[model samples]
Target: MLQYLNPSSAYEALLEFLAAGGNVLVVIMFVAFFMWALIIERIIFWTTAKDGVIKRAKRAWAARTDHKSWYAHAIRDRLISEAKQETERFNGIIRALVAVTPLLGLLGTVTGMVEVFDIMAVTGSSNARLMAGGISKATIPTMAGLVVSLSGLIFINAFERFAKKAEHEVSDELLIE
Candidate 1:
């Protein structure tokens, strides 16, 4: 029996655990952190994108780019046909990113479960201590994934709704008949 009675000198415990296949937990945490970072970056991007769209809408409504002038230019430039496609493309990116996050979380959960089963099958030891380590890591990453995904999802949906409402109000109020 080995006991680390000295809590101050616990470096050996870390070394021992890592030696006992605990490196998997570190990998799981890394994945979670990476996904969290991506989630934050996407959130920032969505905010910036919303701001840009709102500014454009406000400018259009304020007659900075008068519809008559733009319409005339579009007719001259033959870009009127492409305007619908451009709008669709922009909306698609917003919807796709908002919808894809939960899928990412599901992917993480499945990957983690695969790792857990792999670890279990190799050891063939129902040793609670050893098995629990992998299971815990598997679950921790999942928790992180779900938190990030849900936050981003809610923010995205709210932003979309607000943007749509704002766009409609500005367009309806300021369009020069």
Candidate 2:
């Protein structure tokens, strides 16, 4: 088992897995990497810089003496809007990436099936051994796509809640009074 844990061995295993999954799997891997990177960046922003944004908004709001004026309300709206924009950065891209992974996996399936059909036409036989490669190509990417999408869905939901809560909290803190 120690041999299995070797870095070279692990790298080889990864290459083998990618090869089995075919070209679509490679695309899925890259997309999942990007999606996770964005997710992690968002998490980092929320944990660290997010508070600073809220604090700045609160401080700006607190600085004003006119709490009931129309101009002051406009300023308040602007501050809230800025905060909302900052909070929602990259969310759309992350969501789009998440949504695309499954479709990519489906593309992989189609490509794999086409390969299998070509193999059948050339060989004039339905040999399991010959079709196994295409089958793996079809199935692995589908599984990978679903797995990536589900994981991303979980984070996306959490981030949505976090963003809403942060917006609400900011709104509450920036009182008109």
Candidate 3:
């Protein structure tokens, strides 16, 4: 019986998983890591930085005495636009990273299939056990990529909603005449 708590065994299992996943899994891992990092940063900003932004915008608006003029309205709009842009920063990049993950996984699948084909061509045998490793390689990265993308998707939507709500709240605070 193998002990799951053993560090050596755990390391060996990780190596096997990576070997079964091929080179593309490495790319998927990198993308997934950065994507999650960005997601966590965004969530932190929402928790901490968001209120500071709103407060600053409110303060700026509160300082303005000139109201009920076209120029003043334009200034208010600009403030709102700036705040919205700040809230939206890095979002497109996050979405792009999420989009790229699955493509990398697909690439892994293609490479793994090619390896399996190469093996069959060399040995001239359709052996199930031999082919199973290649199949695992092809599927593992796809699963990893999909899992990463799906997890990121939730945070992406939440970030957008948070930004939109912040914009609305700031706009209300600005109180256009």
lDDT of each: 0.50, 0.93, 0.87
CA RMSD (A), model 1:
8.3
C-alpha lDDT of residue 33 in model 3: 85
Per-residue CA lDDT of model 3 for 1-177, tens digit only, reads 467579999888877878879888888888888998898899889978998888888888888898678988988888899899989888998999888888888988898898889789988999988888888888999998888888888888888898999999989999975
Residues 1-177 of candidate 2: C-alpha lDDT, one tens digit per residue: 687699999889889999999999999999999999999999999889999999999999999999899999999999999998999898898889889999999999999999899889999999999999999999999999999999998988888888898899899999987
Per-residue alpha-carbon lDDT of candidate 1 for residues 47-156, written as tens digits (9 for 90 to 100): 56544554554454455444467664444233322322322333444445445544554555566567677777888866676666566545554554455556556655
For all candidates, what are the clash counts?
A: 0, 0, 0
lDDT of 3: 0.87
> Largest lDDT belongs to which candidate?
2
TM-scores of the models, in the order given: 0.49, 0.96, 0.92
Off by over 4 Å in 1: 1-98
Consecutive 10-residue window with the lowest summed lDDT within model 3: 1-10
Clashing pairs in 2: none
Could you give the candidate ranking by TM-score, starting with the highest? 2, 3, 1
Order candidates by lDDT, high to low.
Answer: 2, 3, 1
- The regions of model 2 sitting more than 4 angstroms off are 1-4
